[model samples]
Target: MSKLVLSELTLSHFRSHKRATVALDGRPIAIFGPNGAGKTNLLEAVSLLSPGRGMRRAGADDLTRRPEALGWKITAILGSLHQTHELETWAEAGNPRQLRIDGKAAPQVALGRIARILWLVPSMDRLWIEGAEGRRRFLDRATLSFEPTHADAVLSYEKAMRERNRLLKDMVRDPHWYSAIEAQMAEAGATIQRNRQDTIVQLMAAQNAAPTAFPTANLTLTSPDPIPDDLQMALADNRGRDMAAGRTLIGPHRADLDAVFAEKGTLARDCSTGEQKALLISLILANGRALARDFGAPPILLLDEVAAHLDATRRAALYDEIDALGAQAFMSGTGPELFSELDDRAQYIEVTETDRESVVMQRTSL
Candidate 1:
């Protein structure tokens, strides 16, 4: 059995899915159907099993089923190692999302400790060509997987930065007003940087330790300018400039992730679309491998429309790698042929759309 798996998932009033239930075994899942059949919606629901706003970064209001707008609920049975966790999350219309674990109320970060989930969506195809925000978000996700408390540090940092920026925008010059906030930012920022650096190190080690069809990527964490040894002092020194710019600058917020296609020694930004996609898959797989050691089980992977981007050989190789790693990955494709390589190694879920609502027709094991 896969070390980590979602044995069951139920979605209600989420996106195009009015109500859908899927019972799964500990194997890679192949979700296939025509476009708009809600395959991705299933993966999105699994993504919410971890921290954050799911893979789409959607708000609670946006997740509510339209016309009804009664909000949504997702419940799952997660198998982590030998332990089974009953997880539930829901939102009431326009209200904030809430989480309950093992039938007890819990914070989102608490979920991080029980489940390590990673994802790759179609919109991320532009990760290299797009702005640094996407890359940073990806790096942070990786970091958060390794350190569940990374979310707390990130929240603290962002909260403090927002306050600092507000002061800057208001042109507040009082040193006292900035002292406490700067200290908070510096402390959290340092933790964030260290956690990210450790994640990159772990990912690289995982890649070199194993061989796969995917190419290696050399990663580096960079900043727009040199980050100072004394972050608090640096913030104080740059206050005048920050006030002029109406925002705080030169911290982890300005940091960017750089990647090179190691085999070709070319920047990821310069690689072909297909090559870029392979690199991403490699990293995600490596992240899973590393987590298997750290978390005592492999991570649950969410790969949306990923098979459509790879050739038959690579697709087979991807399945083989996932099997070798013992990860229960959820993958979506438009047709079953895209995942033919999975054969008896996977469980298939067929979905279809009728009258604007996505329905789970059946799940067949081949």
Candidate 2:
């Protein structure tokens, strides 16, 4: 099978690392450090190699190093499908982020074609109990992993919805004004919905086909109101209600992802905290396995502080699964002992903060 890996990574004036570079050999990376040691920052840099804001969702200004607040930059050597590509993403003085492939300027969406990234972060532990937006974002990320064009569809839908919301806010009553924008929204929203549905199908099939230590989650897409079969007409018909609400009321934007523990038949939100985490891990693993089967390579996984959340046996199982999949997963934790299960199967990196500067030290080999 072909492999996708970041063979080399360099961070300049980004977060706590003024300048840091790491060369990799496609093994799962085990990063451990004390609190505030900037371990997550490294994962954030890897996330930037893909589309959208990094995992922190911080604005350009927020990613710049403090004191100087200079712009931040991340450059990577991406190994995908047996080919190598150089990727560079940076922001200058709080300007919009820029992307380059092989030293030529490129759009952010282009990155998705070359690199597929999937992540499980600490903040996502409460995904089941949180508002629908978080769940929607999570679902969208998984969709984007399977279909890179999903990003373009999401951006287009959001743009059209923003314009429609503005018109509604202005109390525009003209049918022609709403017609074109609603058409755009309908087209993009349909694609978004279809992509999400397809992704859920893939995840379900993956979970059912593979036996894993993690609990299986039955996933479904739902919305507060019935989704119209004809979104354009729905948008036009609901303009009055939307105008009253001052927003686009019925679309994929309002969609929610509902999940249940397949064996227990209990809602994810009602499951114990550990069960919830396990379910999420199950989904993420299933997503990776499905992508591996479809794309010829599994994605680079950013599992931030995941080891600390699981007991030794489960942690070992997670490592074994990742290794068996031949995925280069970057996992972070607060101490080296958290990653003891990985032992010789993964590369170990120790991050430390000293004198207000972060240092990354390679502590183990492949």
What is the TM-score of each predicted model, taking all chains together?
0.98, 0.98
Model 2 misses residue 59 by how many Å? 1.6
CA lDDT for candidate 1: 0.92
Report the lDDT tens digits of candidate 1 across residue range 294-328: 99999999999998579999999999999999898
lDDT per residue for candidate 2 within 208-289, as digits (tens), equals 9987999999998999997888999999989989999999889999999999999999999999999999999999999999
Alpha-carbon deviation at 18 in model 1, angstroms: 1.4
Q: Relative to the unseen true structure, what is the Cα RMSD of model 1?
A: 1.2
Off by over 4 Å in 1: none
Mark the regions of model 2 whose C-alpha exceeds 4 Å error after superposition. Answer: none
- The window of 10 residues in a row where model 2 has the poorest summed lDDT is 357-366
